[model samples]
Target: MTCMRCGREADPPPRHRIGFPAPVKERILQSICAECWKEWEGVEVKVINEYRLSFLDPQHREMLQKACFDFLKLPEQA
Candidate 1:
């Protein structure tokens, strides 16, 4: 698989365990490599802490999803 973030040939991430919808999940699985996803996992924690995001808020979840897409270098969602 060619990573969308690094543009390198590498293995795909393990699975779609996150709560994103099927289409978004499919895009990530196909475009994001395992290494990038692992990196994002680390970044995700920082983002949550820095922003004081609570999963109980829908807006915060959307914000995090946008951040994830930006970090992955994916195009904007429709």
Candidate 2:
């Protein structure tokens, strides 16, 4: 199959693990090639929720901080 993103021809598709906790199974999974997966591994999600939370009346800053800390303490992959 051809990769939708890179237009490269791919070998028989291998199952991909992208979403955490629950895995997302793609049907037309040929959209991304192996090279795209390698590049995606380096992408980072920044903590930008603070700006949005500032508008809340109760100010969930403390709760949000604790959640962030707890998430960071999750077990690391071997």
Candidate 3:
């Protein structure tokens, strides 16, 4: 499928967590390509450190999620 972020035709993640939250999973399956997602992984770490985020905190996780999604150019869920 063509990736919404990269406009490349590539395979999706093999084990995408379908059970993940609706917005998260939908973006993965519908808009984000695997390569872009991997790139987002590194950026996500930087964001976490730059913001001094604790993964255990729900607010922190939410912030990270939005950042990662935005960096991947995954349009906001409607």
Each model's TM-score?
A: 0.87, 0.39, 0.80
Which candidate gets the maximum TM-score versus the true structure? 1
* Clash counts for all predictions: 0, 0, 0
lDDT of 1 by residue, 12-62 (tens): 888855567688888899999999999999999999999999888989988
Q: Which pairs clash in model 2?
A: none
Cα lDDT for residue 25, candidate 2: 26
Worst 10 residues of 2 by lDDT: 19-28
Alpha-carbon RMSD, candidate 1: 1.5
Query: Model 1 off-target regions past 4 Å?
Result: none
Q: C-alpha displacement of 9 in model 2, angstroms?
A: 0.4
lDDT of 3 by residue, 1-78 (tens): 888888999866544533246667765877767787778767877997899998788898788778866787766665
Worst 10 residues of 3 by lDDT: 11-20
- lDDT tens per residue, model 2, 6-66: 5789752346444322212242243556565544433312332434544143445444333
lDDT agreement with native, every candidate: 0.87, 0.41, 0.73
